[model samples]
Target: MTAKILRTRLDCVDYQEACDRIQNWAIQRNSCYVIAANVHVIMTAYWRKSYQQILNRAALVTPDGMPLVWGIRLLQNAQQTRVYGPDLMLAWCDRAAQSNLSIYLYGTTETTLVSLTRHLQQRFPSLRIAGSYAPPFRALTPVEEMADRDRIHASGASVVFVALGCPKQEEWMARQQGNLQAVMIGVGAAFGFHSGEVSQAPRWMMRFGLEWLYRLITEPQRLWKRYLINNPAFVVLFGLQLVRGLIKGQ
Candidate 1:
């Protein structure tokens, strides 16, 4: 099921169900994209129509943050749990190993990719990583883009884990549908976190929805506006939505 939180569709899927769906898609070689929607991602989509369309058309838009999980529970289903990107990537890796599915890694720095690949192999010994590429940080030229696509296509990967981060990653995946014959998942910062290049919030903080606070404290310069501005705006907008729902129910 899905719920509209601040006008963005969030799938009310638990971790296991999400992994199963992605695995099935990979096995079938379907061209699709999965989005791990957090508060920042949701708020961005709420304000940007183009981005919202990208998310709405996604094969799966998992509630990746506690706020989204809570929002889905309040608005739609009470059983919704977070299908976080980093954790989801790990789960998929384990499943891929067990099933002998091949995966390709895209985005992030080459150094981080090397570390992440090592970590994944160390954790999931049987996992077949078809290939990996770290594109230039700037926008890719049309020819460059085609080359990248060809590279991925020729690699014969069933699943491509894209770590380009939120809006950009989402947009890239949307453009690749039909053009890319594999499941493309926009996993945002999973590469960095998994590679140990970046720190993650404690499990306690994540469970209590304080992961944002931890991120803000750690990367204040980059994340302050996102958390401070977008978060409060989301609360106000979602609160209004709840009020309207209540009024209609009454």
Candidate 2:
């Protein structure tokens, strides 16, 4: 089967296997690595047709949130551990090091980008880092956007880790498809995770569906609406769909 065919509804491969798929695809050098991202993305998929199309069309969409795994299981019973963003970044970095694949860092603040680069270099002492950039917060003109793409192409990087959060990153990757010769993965908060600006929830908290809560507590000002409002709404919608599915089965 192709790497991303829905296995039940969980719609994901496990970790070591995810790494293998990415490495094999990177070796092929003809495609982008589209991360399935997280609950917000899956919730958006349910609410937004455009987001749904983006997820479905992605070459690979690994389950990046626990709620997404549950939703996938609700649709069809499937095992899926959270393939969260930070973990995905580490997986790709290790692969890049072992395979001699160069990488470019894009998005996030310049300070974060610098720290991430140095940390990766320290961890993977032999890793080839082709380049790094931090774009202005404002929208780019067509020429400016194309110029950035050209810079990445010129950097000779085989993989680009983009940290420009959610729909923005997904939209950016879609636009750059077949334009730059490498894989571009939109990794959300992974830049902060690797740089020590955010703390990861304990594994048990993640398993128990409270990681969002942990995050909400940590950054309540930024996340109150996303978790307190959106997450509950997602649960209610998903539960209804699951109930309907069960009834149909009987």
Candidate 3:
């Protein structure tokens, strides 16, 4: 089942369950997308009907942020936990290696892709990386878009990990839904985290739902508004949602 977070329908699956579901999709060669729902994701969807439709139609919308995990616990599931994007990517990579699934990486810079692919191959020695591409930051021309689709299709990848971040990644996956023949997962900053370009929060901080603070401190300039504005807003808005749910006996 999915838990309602504002306007988004977030899948109420734990880490293992999410992994199993993705594995099944890969095996079936399904063209589907997964979004890792965070506070920013929910808030973005709250304001954007187009993005909200994307989230609503996703194959799985895992709670990638601590706040969303707590939101699910409060609203629907009592034992909800975070299915973090970076960690989930790693888990999928591990399972893909064992299952002999060839994977492709999309988005991020060439440098990060090099480092990420190297580290992933190091971590999962038997993993097959079918291909990797770092699209230009600007919107792709039709020719370029077709090239990307052709490259991925020709690579024979069963799973494609997208690290374009936010609505861009989600939107890109949505665009490729029918055109691509692989399970597309919008992994946001997993490329940076896996490539060693960005450090992740410690296990203790993550366990305590303070990873956002760590990220805010690490990249204050880039993330200040997202954490500062969105965090408080989500608290207030979601609090109201909780109160409404309670009054209705949900």
Candidate 4:
């Protein structure tokens, strides 16, 4: 186990560690959710106690963004790397191929799912993609939600990668816990990035914590508020938490 940054419940774990834990969850058929904690997610939880409880209850919360990596290092006195959600999805797919773990993909457009499945199976030839589905972009009726759950259960998937984005994906995973006997990971935009439907930031930018800037530039209309508002708010709030911790000498 890795030391956690208590402010955001950011686990100070690297990619390999996260993959190992996911593989363990698959073997155990555990019903739990993995959150990829980024600045936006941290800020969202900060502003909403309900959302914070969701984060608190997550089985694993990887430091997905570089700022979170930095936060863990600064606060925990331990170095940590970003376990990026998109890359983690790929890593798990590669491991799943060798381990014989079947997976399901939920959320995103049908076209994106098609492309993602194609690319994944091409890369990990032995990977078992049990099924994929793109739900309608609206709240599902109870019957529809149950049908979706049954579809996943019937597919015999050991892991489900959800791409519904942020709080919605987290909430959905929370609701499915225990009811869904598989690892439910909220992977945000992994579907788009993996399928090449959306370009990812370059390695240099990602390493330097500039991935958010790249994303903001790429999809300004959709991401402007998230980056512009959440980023600064996280910095300020986390700084306060740090100061308070120091005053208390934790």
User: In model 3, where is the ten-residue run with the lowest total lDDT?
Assistant: 67-76
Segments of candidate 4 deviating more than 4 angstroms: 1-7
Query: Over all chains combined, what TM-score does candidate 4 have?
Result: 0.96
Model 2 TM: 0.91
* Candidate 4 per-residue C-alpha lDDT over 1-250 given as tens digits, one digit per residue, 9 for 90 to 100: 4544434576767778888999999899999999998888988887888989999999999889888888878877466678999888988998899999999999999999999999998899999999999999998888888899999999999999999998899988988888998999999998999898889899999999999999999999999999999888888877887898799996
Give per-residue CA lDDT, model 1, range 144-226, as digits (tens).
Answer: 88899999999999999999877889999998999999999989989999999999999999999999999999999999999
Screening candidate 1 with a backbone cut-off below 3 angstroms (N, C-alpha, C), the clashing residue pairs are none
lDDT winner between 2 and 3, please give it: 3
Candidate 3 stretches greater than 4 Å from native: none
Write candidate 2's Cα lDDT for 1-250 as tens digits: 2222222123457677777877776778856756755767766666777867777666677777877766655554465566777888888788879889888999999899888888889999989989999999888899999999999989988788888877788878877887877887788888998887778888899888788888988999988887877787877876777777679999
Off by over 4 Å in 2: 1-10, 74-78
Q: For candidate 3, what is the TM-score?
A: 0.97
Stretches of candidate 1 exceeding 4 Å from the true structure: none
Candidate 3 lDDT tens digits, 1-250: 8788888888888878998999999899999999998999999898789999999889999999888888888787998888999889999998899999999999999999999999999999999999999999988898898899999999999999999888899999998998898999999999999999999999999988898899999999999998899889999999999898888985
Give all TM-scores, in the order shown: 0.98, 0.91, 0.97, 0.96
Best model number under TM-score: 1
TM-score winner, 1 or 2: 1
- The models' CA-based lDDT, in order, is 0.92, 0.77, 0.92, 0.89
